[model samples]
Target chain A: MKDRPLILVTNDDGITAPGLRALIEVMNELGDVFVVAPDSPQSGTGHAITSNATIYCTAITIDEGDQIEYSSSGTPVDCVKLAVNEILNRKPDICVSGINHGSNSSINVIYSGTMSAAVEAGIEGIPAIGFSLLDYDWEANFEATKKYVKKITQKVLDHGLPEGVVLNVNFPKLKEKDIKGIRICRQAKAYWEEDFDKRTNPNGKQYYWLSGKFVNKDKGQDTDEWALANGYVSLVPVMFDLTAHHAIQKLNSLGFNEK
Target chain B: MKDRPLILVTNDDGITAPGLRALIEVMNELGDVFVVAPDSPQSGTGHAITSNATIYCTAITIDEGDQIEYSSSGTPVDCVKLAVNEILNRKPDICVSGINHGSNSSINVIYSGTMSAAVEAGIEGIPAIGFSLLDYDWEANFEATKKYVKKITQKVLDHGLPEGVVLNVNFPKLKEKDIKGIRICRQAKAYWEEDFDKRTNPNGKQYYWLSGKFVNKDKGQDTDEWALANGYVSLVPVMFDLTAHHAIQKLNSLGFNEK
Candidate 1:
């Protein structure tokens, strides 16, 4: 008989988040689970790694389950590093992050701790997936996402993901039956327009809270934004190579190489 | 009379870093400069933005220069956002982040706060560039880099970067005369292998400090790593879009789309 696959789980919404709990339940049915995630919500933390600071990772039990879990006072990227190097006995067969509280579609992936965990895993040669719900509420239901999540995990374990790519899977806020099939998509061209809320503190000093409106101008039907907007689960294959290869020839032609 | 170009300067190595001061001196000759950077070092913070926390941006004078400066209690990405949304009278003509104390080439870009600032500015539709020297010393000689910096900045001003692209310029730790001409290149495939140092405190609790060894296996001569190795300044055009478009077709063929 084949031994159960070792599955690693994590998230940006902390260990106690319902989203994490829901993911834990689904992952428990799949393999021998090991979870190490943030001790507090680390949303919008991006690909940050803690430096020159001491990180604390302690074993914890949130609820009775088959998974052995630990919580770390570190960023999502930190958690993945800790998991791969120090926590587990061996590198896991697969790693999954989130069931994040909100969407990480389009341009959100750049500023996402949830996706950062998955990307960190991918860099370490692990096939990884990051899942998100379109709803922002902390108590948002993740029931509809479980079946799709299970399906995708099976497919990944069945045939490993392409090298240097990780999955950015986002589900629309719908019931299990109401959800449409998944669509393979590309990241939509989008940006946030920052609108700072400047206020005077008790000391009569000004401080600003960052707030922004998501502006998606890409109308392409093949984009993640369009897929999620209509009804399908959006799956974007993301890569970390930021090189704009197409511009290299153009740059060479500009003759900046000359003194 | 024609007005000078507005230049926004920032870094991940803190507001008072010598590299930043050197960059300020170079930028002063070209245009009016606004310097908004982290009050403390924010290296490796990536694209993180402050949320649900008050950020302080204070006006300050580091030295007698025409460049206006502010120190922010935020990450590099925050500095760029605040500069664009609240501080500036108009959008900056160009945003240049860092003559960083260390390299952000290859996989390091994913963990770099310096490049994050440039990426954030690029997201806001500003022409942006991030510069780094191979040297990590606090007092590294930036003298050799000044002329090349001037030349590149002039070229960028004369011929704008391609749409959705920004430059990542990394100089080798060589004398000015020894430096070979610039080479437009692609990012090399590389990753860090974490080597966390575990320690026990007086409280009998174990903690870790993150450290790592950079490993590069890609032998492409057209890569940034190769360019830097050959005593040449490597110029890589970077884009913020994370989509792996080529892998989308292969993913679609996997048949996960079917219910």
Candidate 2:
């Protein structure tokens, strides 16, 4: 285990984002880091890939760093695919995404490009983790997140993740000392209650601004939303297999075969 | 159940696509249909929503049909959100997406806008199903898929879907007489073996076109890929909860709280 591990780092907030830079700095200390991320912000793009068009990626240095980096004209998921299929000579020991500029707790994970990038890596049999800070500001302090990031990344590299699983980790916006310990939890049953602000355009056409309120309906203590709200970093193990195995029997009983 | 059911219909291949129109026709026989679909093809958009910009939607009639329709300048998931939040006066009994022009069985589901629309509807507590045929042509014949689509949809309407679950149905590209009966199966373990075609642009920059071959590594006959290949309509009960519940205990054993 003395050999240095190969690490792939990426984020949904684009290559030049402070959140990604913070992630790169933390990962640089642990292993050889290669960054393949979007050229522009792609926050809620989910698991989207660039299938309808061609993607352009450029090799460039963003700062005084040892990490090899590429800026992709594609989504976060596309970046991961491109990294694994086009850029890297070998599969990395671990893939880490984000240290994102906002929260991806509970239902928010469904619409997150950060988690999607990690999930993409996981689908390709790589141990992966997606990290998010509970702050949306571009200049939000990532100082308190560094140690935890290092700890979790080290633990995952030491002990590979279970089959078909990836980690969705979120940090509460607290100072290093003030933050509570990390908690292993499930995703809470929460949703964004949307409120579409409708308006008319100069061309007399109708348009809408999709805004929503985050509504956490679950009262369970063993959930990510509860952990994050209580100032702990929440880690939820997520998978790509979306099968509802328990419901299969009931669906089978409906007897579609019956005349 | 004597009152006519309200059915919300949509697709990733745009509102006027032949596949979407076929779905609408089949749905029309069972209930009052309302269409809210993308204005253009949105394949591979996954669970993306319109978060970074304004979305424009307009009411239009694509055919001499009884269904009311709207085309939105957003992704497939956005069409669902728009339909439920702004377009429909009351919640539809069921939401159906696609009869998509390509196969969305196994690993393809992760990157499919067709499944994403259905998954979005499931999240909103609406019973939903996404249908696809194993053909990618714009003029693919959907005649053999109609009977199965009708039966599955009718069954769903009669027996409500379990909470957090939706259905993914795929038919083989066979003649009506050659198709076998429908089979209930799990999603197959599969992935795309990506082959990125690198090219030099006129500006002397390199670009890549994402292409891949569908690789089904699993030999299990109880999987969707197997069922589809065997000339059957495959139905897999899909869920919105991404939590890997089995990995929770393993993750908890990490003891991140130890002093």
Instruction: State each model's C-alpha RMSD to the native.
Output: 1.1, 1.3
Q: For residues A1-259, what per-residue lDDT tens digits would candidate 1 score against the true structure?
A: 1488899999998999998899889988889999999999999999999996899999999999989999999999999999999888788899999999999999999999999999999999999999999999998988899999999988998899999999999999998888779999999999899999999999999989999899999999999999999999999999988999888889999999676
Chain A TM-score of candidate 1 vs. true chain A: 0.98
What ranges in model 1 sit over 4 Å off? Answer: none
lDDT of 1: 0.93
Q: How many backbone clashes does candidate 2 have?
A: 0
How would you encode candidate 1's per-residue C-alpha lDDT over B75-174 as one tens digit per residue? Answer: 9999999999999979998999899999989988889999999999998988898999999899898999899888898789778889899999999999
TM-score of chain A of each: 0.98, 0.98
DockQ values, each candidate: 0.89, 0.83
Native interface contacts retained, candidate 2? 0.77
Question: Candidate 2: which stretches are off by over 4 Å?
Answer: none
lDDT per residue for candidate 2 within B1-259, as digits (tens), equals: 3388999999899998999999998998999998999999999999999888999889989988788899999899999999998889889999999989999999788889999999999988999999999999999999989988998999999998999999999989999889888888899989888889999989898999999888889999889999988988889999878999999999989877666
TM-score of each: 0.98, 0.98
